[model samples]
Target: MTDAPDQIPEPEEGAAADSAEHPESLGDDGEFGGVEEFDADARDAADAVYAALLERVGEGAPRPRLEPTRRAVELLGDPHRSAPVIHLTGTNGKTSTSRMIESLLRASGLRTGLLTSPHLERFTERIRIDGESVRDEVLARNWEEIEPFIAIVDAELEGAGESPLTFFETFTVLAFACFADAPVDVMVLEVGMGGEWDSTNVADGQVAVITPIDLDHQSRLGNDVVEIARTKSGIIKPSASVVSARQQDDVLKVLENAADLTESTLAVEDDAFAVISTTVAVGGQLVSIRGLAGSYHDIALPLFGSHQAQNAAVAVAAVEAFIGSGSVRLADEVVETGLGAVTSPGRLQIVGSGPTVIVDAAHNPHGAGSLVASLGEAFDFDEVVIVLGVLADKDATGIVDVLAGLDARFIVTNPGSDRAADTDRVAGIVATRVGADRVTVIERLDDALDEARDWATEGEKRAVVVTGSVVLVGDAIAIAADRGWNAR
Candidate 1:
């Protein structure tokens, strides 16, 4: 583990773990105890107050709304200025890439702060200070402390005839402020969606990274690959260096143009830095990558899938570029240790044994393609049963087309959220591609996963995947954890 600077000690020292409502001293009499033990009416009021503010994703405000966040910082005295950041945006691999970057930086002995979204189970997974969840008491206190600023942002926005900030936007602002207060050495900020309008882009980053570009978020970004890539390319700022994957000619042109527009230096994969020959194994991958700094061979990643290798190459390049050619070079052992320590939840996460339940938040065509490939090469299941869900916003036909050719019988379900693809609607799409006889649409995620598990018997090797949206994967993980599902 990296050593924390004297300015920012390890979280265990009571610096990062200490929060208002979640201090280490409180036993169990907090807000989440028994409803009868606390003020139910007060809690209900607070929930309602924030519920409306959380309604902004995939609904309204496709363009960047940095003003509200800016107002928030001003009210709080510009906390964002305190944190250094590596902002990441793309169609896929943002979370995995973020984890890799965070871990690599941490390996250099810097106190790392990672903030991600659509957590598998607990909300705390979204914010980690010094490699741990924010102590519950601390988060609760910060929540209360930040509430006034949020409410003020809401009022001013509403008075200006604009909708309130969405859940993700609020989260972006909160994370920036919280990390600034914790004063982490650097933050790995993953764009919640497309980069141009993503709330996380509000922060000024010293480095910008773009992973593989594909067709996703067409409604807000655009229909063409270049348009979408342009949206993601928005994260590139003046004076920042770019580390990106190999992209289509058109998409590559767009990325370069954006880099030029921002006056940021661009490092093209396969040209300046590249990942060479690769081999995938059960626990990790072995690949040789050559970058502007140097070449690394057979570096292993603790995560699954080939896409992760690409993400790792991008991480390795970013670290090298950010630190320049001298003092902060990434030692080969740091690369090994960094990749070994990195893990992203719900991205081919093997959550249990007995029947082998895996969770992946592969809601789009590109992601679905990667998940299908990973299953084929990594596991040897005689039968693969997929428990799937999706958002209404996704192109259901496109998603199904990619997974249909894979060896899996899908038990489809509606994601347990308003954004979920309608169960009947999703089933209709699946039936067209994979046959209705093989597709079953159940409204509940738990029921779908349970049915997939039961069919895994009969003296046959079977693997079950709970996938599609993070909401569905999250629900499946919650059930597995409650029942003590084992991943080994």
Candidate 2:
């Protein structure tokens, strides 16, 4: 990896001379910060910045190389080192776990920065500071200052006959810069993909959190669970405190080896930390978690599912690992408050009432099983209609098998992603498992939702669930919001 930049670069020769001649161009900060005379100008500038980022590389395909991100951040004075980092990685529950960790740290009276991936609605949702999405002005301003350094690296890579940085690599640099500019005390970074080569891995975390590694990204990670676990275990740094969720035997062996090599303190779920009990409640669930420090009882997690209960357990342990290196226990009130206020947007998130509509980002069999279990535990629906859209590379058959036992009808559709499996393909899979008569094919998600809503309204205790891909969950969320469905 390239060494961190010694200092922010000086202006170009012409700009320096122009600044000397015209004092107003320099501004007080000397970095393009002046009073915006109108809101429209700021909005237009933000739009331009977002467009420029999208133009460089699309999010769907990312080249897994850290050299470009390393070079880019090196030229920006290595802002990633400004705060202590809590790095998180796993096949499932990474985003939800990251959100929980951020909430816990923020409740501890620290200014926190959070960077997570696959935003449900806006790109701004990826970078959050102090529990809120970063403002458009802040994103635009950071892009203005960081663009020149990125351009330098882009030219160098192209000159060497290599492609420019991918979308996620560049965004990683932006997140680091924004967090450093905010001057946060702690930063919680969730990996965009695998851990070792992910751009966000440039920062050595003080604590590493792994949440239930599974067989989701087999195409990119590996075909087997063991190999995927090995790839994810790379986030655990030497002497770092590691908090991991309960893993299978083969996966656990891989993580143990990684911890041994790194000389890290590893805390496995059901050993060092675990969820004692979870009782379904109104709005969400009440979970009692045995943390690394102490036991937190009856903590209100404003999200559904047993997987979420486990996620809460891991988040508490990660926070405990961060706060006192797993030596000191957090105050009960602090832990209670932090978890009570947590909200995971699309993970078993109910967006509407009256034939309740739920959306979850469960793209694989493991996650799909969790969704089915959670639905059984949390909701008492006599019948259900599921709007399912899966990516082309996913295990459509495995996912359908997991949910086939549920008393539900399937509506297969497109998730607005180029990689989405064809509606007919998914419908065939659903039909093979649950019978052809129980399956419906609606190519568009909006139309699928309309049909599901009609089905849900026909029965006494019926509901609708949208799942299979993050892209579909994002689209469903936007559609629900547009139709005035309040997210709970």
Candidate 3:
């Protein structure tokens, strides 16, 4: 492990394990004793840390540079330098690709740490050590140890009239600290947004993975596809192995230029590796992929979409780059088991039955297009009802346009997020794209979902798709589970 500067000490001594004001701690009365008390303590501690981090700037706001994160980690002894990193960034597919890569590495007998962003449910979903979300106690304890150091940095930045570290930056710091404490063999990191100054970029990745780049986050990243690709290309470190998905001509040029400048070896989809075919199966789909070193055939990836197949191909190449320099074939069993074990929580995930409720976190047009295509290819629904909710800053028109041509009814609602676009505004957009008669306006996601289920249950071969934002998908999952609906 890389040493912290001046031997960073442990958490402040004598800090309360369970504070009185904590909601969970309050339940620690006789009503909740023994294991329940222990569990409450864990939850309380984790929430305490989360509440503190949420006080900073929001995750959507990108910091201009990595200085704050760099300094925070530096003061804490640079925990990120402890493990080699596989850094991933792009408009979409980053989380799924990162998860696949982590599974593959773990199957090969390496303890893996995976750090992803915009988690669907719990904040702990953002950091996983050895394939499981870090325990609440561990996450809170790590934060407790680092809180003082973070405050010191915050004071320094405030003295200089600079903003304190944002939510994502602090989470990045905590992830590094947690991963180092776990002493993982390798870590897979997904950038929050554009790559150049992303807090996760503070660590030089040994294998930089770029999934299909698209025009999303145009306000923060540039409008042009090539320009967005250029910003994402920042993760390619000198001599690092670069694995990229198939890209547009201009995007390819930008990536090629970055690889050349960094003297990195580049492997691109359709050229070096690609998903040749995918056939829908019982649970998911069977795919055949041509990887960099060898061809993987008859691989069953339990995820929807040809895009996921593509993501699997990219993940294999990245793992090859990290473990074998893209020259050696992973064992067939290892490849099969690893790919099969992968689970992308909210990407075309089926969270309930009866109505066959499916949820996907497709916030942008490109992702929406992919989701629509996958739905067409994967399911045999006679009629589909879509529960749509989008963030205020998203391309709502583009999303509506993509789904307009589908044989589906639209239920526009909010995802229960402050950033969620108003239901009336979303309905107006949907109405413009696909006549208002086809669009149903609902204020709450749960009510919208109920309406969708009623519509689905009314006929044979009907289904429901909850989408447009990760928050909506999370809500759908919670609602389904609470209602005792079996996630098919």
| TM-score for each model | 0.86, 0.91, 0.92
Q: Which runs in model 2 stand beyond 4 Å of their true positions?
A: 1-40, 486-488
> Candidate 1 residues 102-180, lDDT tens each?
8788777787777776566656577776666554445555666787888898898889998776677777677766677
RMSD of 2: 10.7
Decide which is better by lDDT, 1 or 3. Answer: 3
lDDT of 2 at 389: 95
Q: Give candidate 3's error at residue 20 in angstroms.
A: 28
- lDDT tens digits by residue: candidate 2, 1-488: 11121222232343212111121232245243232233566567777877888887776666767888988888999998999999999989999999889888877988899999988776777887776666567778999899999889889999999989878888999999999998789999999888988989999999999988888768788889998998889898889999999999999999999999999999999999899988777767778888887898877777788899999999999999999989789998778767876768889988777779999999999999999998888877888889999999899999999989795899999999878898898899899888999998999889999999988888898999999999999999879978976643
Find the 10 residues in a row with the least total lDDT in model 3.
Answer: 1-10
Full-model lDDT, candidate 1 = 0.74
Best by TM-score: 3
Quote the positional error of residue 75 for candidate 2 in Å: 0.8
Per-residue accuracy of model 3 over 330-445 as CA lDDT, tens digit each: 99977887887787888998888887999999999899999988887887788898999999989999988888768679999888888888889989988888788999888887
lDDT score at residue 74, model 3, on the 0-100 scale: 98
In lDDT terms, which candidate is top? 3
**Which sequence of candidate numbers ranks them by TM-score, best first?**
3, 2, 1
The CA-based lDDT of model 3 is what? Answer: 0.85
